[model samples]
Target chain A: MKKTKHKILDMLLKHPDIHLSGQKICDVLGCSRTAVWKHIKELESEGFKIEAIQKKGYRLLSTPNELSEARILVGLKTKELGQHLIYFDSIGSTQKETQHLAEDGAPHGTLVITSHQMTGRGRLGRTWSMPKGKGIAMSLILRPKLSINRIPQLTLIAAVAVYKAITEVTGIQTDIKWPNDILVMGKKIVGILTEMQTEGTNVKAVIIGMGMNINANKNDFPEEIRHVATSLKTLTGKEHDMSLIVQTILFYFEELYLRYLEEGFSVIKWMWESHAVSIGKRINARLFNGKVLTGLAKGIDEEGALLLEDDQGSIHKIYSADIEIE
Target chain B: MKKTKHKILDMLLKHPDIHLSGQKICDVLGCSRTAVWKHIKELESEGFKIEAIQKKGYRLLSTPNELSEARILVGLKTKELGQHLIYFDSIGSTQKETQHLAEDGAPHGTLVITSHQMTGRGRLGRTWSMPKGKGIAMSLILRPKLSINRIPQLTLIAAVAVYKAITEVTGIQTDIKWPNDILVMGKKIVGILTEMQTEGTNVKAVIIGMGMNINANKNDFPEEIRHVATSLKTLTGKEHDMSLIVQTILFYFEELYLRYLEEGFSVIKWMWESHAVSIGKRINARLFNGKVLTGLAKGIDEEGALLLEDDQGSIHKIYSADIEIE
Candidate 1:
């Protein structure tokens, strides 16, 4: 049902300058003229401004702030990433849906995205909550031909990609926290979660989930996290176009991802460290086993582990921990 | 259908010396006496010997040399490893099925075993072939509280468990190969493949697959692998009970796995080194990137990576490689 609508919309959105006739839409979509008319009416009902003429056909005048495959695909210039996008109005977790898709042989660069996440999740079993139509909740499926040890590098790559996208889209400065948190004004604005499915040392699939607080007000966050969470609208004092932001992020992510595949993590590592907030700073890391160590953050190693120099002047590799800047 | 048969067989196998009445079986299984009699006839046709006394009920006389859930569970002594067992006569791959089960929330220590594997696989995209009904193909699911870097040690632990089980069952000495193979008299006898599912640094589940050649004749193997592969029947002069071997392996695996959880991989590392075939010998290791190096095998490190001392006396850690004894 929605597939035909999306196809018709794609034709209309691609050539917004010229009107696409109903006959042409039917011919391209292999449907009846009545079906095309019905789809155009439905698109209009969904806040799409479509101008329909007697014989000139349909012209896409404007699109709603809503996310659609047609809207995203029209502006997305990636070769493969975002080429196959699955959009939802609301979903439990894009990560879970993308994992299932990857297991069922979803291609590399397949993206699952939603406007709202009811059961959003973060690293270490944390819950992520966002208001409806106020953020970008997405999971990208990657099938890289790499070993399990090198998978942690992808999370850092995602951090760099999102950092570039955020800075480019809004011209706002942001810092990438050690593992996978993007901060604005010392408050988190985005979170990235990386999950992997592997067979022995061979990697089968990796799901990179990103949840951002884009247009939400500061009060939109839960009371407990209000002090620590900030959104783009709050930082910029205005609401940014969500579709434009999503498209810009996908563009930069595809660029960095392809570069990482051809070369290695060296370039991405440099980018990540340059945008990192904790590098060369005094910090306290709460390890996964409930142990805390205060050290000077010396940056990341080749394997993506945090290199921490303690008071005793010995460097320690920190794998998974929560960092606090001192 | 098989579940009812397994339950009835479990009741009979648990008390082999006592006769179970038809009414008692019907009452316990929540079925009619006709159903019970039908299941008993089916079991009998499947090679289970039962003596029907006109007045005293049905008595089990003996069992066949076959693999069944009840047959293995009756003699199995484990806390939770084999407490939940899924048995099959033939399957594509036990590893695949066990991975699905683990994803669907199959508990830790869940075991998926089959009599044959049509599409068995080894490390680095290698195919493992075995004769029907003449080998042990099983996958165990484990949910541990460890990071992904420490997962390679589970492969070594599985090797040690299988080593102890084979030595205790057949009194046939075997040597542990570097990563996950068992060699008897310089011939490959067992292959273990350890796979993991993880979210960032948290471990979700690890599936350890063991495929062993038990009772196949030398000719049962394909022409390509016959020179490199050997069965228990070829090593010893007779066929071994597949059920007994399964029970013994599960027993030792549960013990060692629990110990690994409480303590670290240190104990398993020492045990593995004691039985390793390449520990103190000169060996050629073909690395993953098509490089070969000749070095002295100087045991394993705490993380289960093979340590090799080169001719220049520098010790190199071998993560994943094909080792050949020189």
Candidate 2:
């Protein structure tokens, strides 16, 4: 089905400078030449410009900035992450699909990406607006063999990954707002939500949902979020290639994830603190129980919990809270 | 559906000492008398003996020892737990069904019960043998607003609940083997597996799977587990009613869950320690990293972690391990 088409497109993109013959594609994919021709026609309908010469084969001229599986897999240099990608033209939520797939034994590094989310979800049961073909709505399935107590460090690790990806891809310098929000020029550009399945102290799987505004303009956001939300297009006044961004994120994520698995969370903590905006600043943290504590935002502890220094110079380890910089 | 049939049987069991007329049953259920008669015939074919007197009514004379929803819900007095029950003649695993139902927004206290589990699962990916119609294979879905760190306590709380239930139902003295195993006469009788869906620090749902060996004779167990596993019938030399055991477990579980929610884990800790068999004994703990540590089991800490005091008097907080009493 679509998998074969993706394989064909992957082969074509693997050698973007040269043309791939239909006979070779048919041989590699174990399909007939007619089927490859049909797939090429389908790809053309999806805004992929392919140049076909007489007996020379087909060359991928240009790919529209779509989050298609083939486009994302073009230059994805990760060894495991994003190797098994599930792309959806539209979906309810990537988190929901990833949960179902994880329950059905989806392996580690399996990715669920959607061009649009009807009901995009955030932390604390909040909803985020994700227009079609405008944002990166994805969920990665991670099976980390770590104790459940150390699960909170995953959010910080993901924040660092996203920060590094954005900087490396788009040359955008973003500040991580405590746990997982990436803010550009004091506006939220990305949100990371980490969920896990645990049996007692054993962590079976971790699904990290990341929503980043990539190509949305100022008018794409709703009136309520216009002042607080910014996208790459709005920040740079140009449309960026989303597939490249996804590929770069996967690359950086796979590296950091492997590093974290090998050598604890020290590197992640250091990277996160280097880009943390609230550290050394006065802030107010709203606890989950409706109590707000005003303090100076010190760096995080060993377990990635925020350290807040109150007026008495005592440090409070804030486990779960919403921070507001003052 | 089987739900309606269970409702009819529930009506019959609600007034076991008296006869229920067909006219009254039809009036209550909003069904025709013919349908009621058909349901009664079906129940009879399923091993339920209903004595129908001429022109008088129908009386439940006796019921086969089966884990039917009607049997389990007959005298259940829980407020929330087991209010919404999904019964199956057989299932692969109640935990699988409960996990799916929880993801689909099943409310708290939803129960998934089966007459048998084709593939009964245990902690750390182990498999348990659950024969058809001989064990209580059930999973309860709990949505508790607690932090992820407090989740490990659920296994201990459920252990205490099951211990109380077994003691009250059969008057058998059982011992809690620290985290989740319930042992009787130095043999395992019950195993509890608690799993959860967590986002950052917020716990969305907790699926508690409990498998108790009930009504199985000595010959019912396999040769491999004969020395390690024991059942209620094997211990008391008499068959026990399993529906009553399930009802009692639900009663105790709901009470303890609510208490843990309001009063914290102090009460649960005391009850768990009172029945814990490993405390004050020398034991060997096999860690997840293939390392074994032998020490004196010196009770659990505040977070329900096993505190192993080694020969050198240094205490080790064992997070994830398999304990073997030496």
Best by lDDT: 2
Task: Please provide, for model 2 over A247-281, each residue's C-alpha lDDT reduced to its tens digit, 9 standing for 90 to 100.
Answer: 88889888888899899888888999999999999
Worst 10-residue stretch by lDDT in candidate 2 chain B? B1-10
List clash counts for every candidate, in order.
0, 0
Please write out the lDDT profile of model 1 over residues B29-88, one tens digit for every residue: 899989889988988986789988876788888776667666787657898887788888
Q: What's the TM-score of chain B for every model shown?
A: 0.92, 0.93
DockQ of each: 0.43, 0.68
Highest DockQ, which number? 2
Summing lDDT over every window of 10 consecutive residues in candidate 1 chain A, give the lowest-scoring window.
Answer: A66-75
lDDT per residue for candidate 2 within B18-120, as digits (tens), equals 8899998999988998999998999898778999986888999988766656777766889989988888889998987888888778999999988688988
lDDT of 1 by residue, A84-161 (tens): 888888889887778767756689989999988899888877889888878889999888888787889999998988
Q: List clashing residue pairs in candidate 1.
A: none
Name the docking class for model 2.
medium
DockQ-derived CAPRI band for the predicted complex in model 1:
acceptable
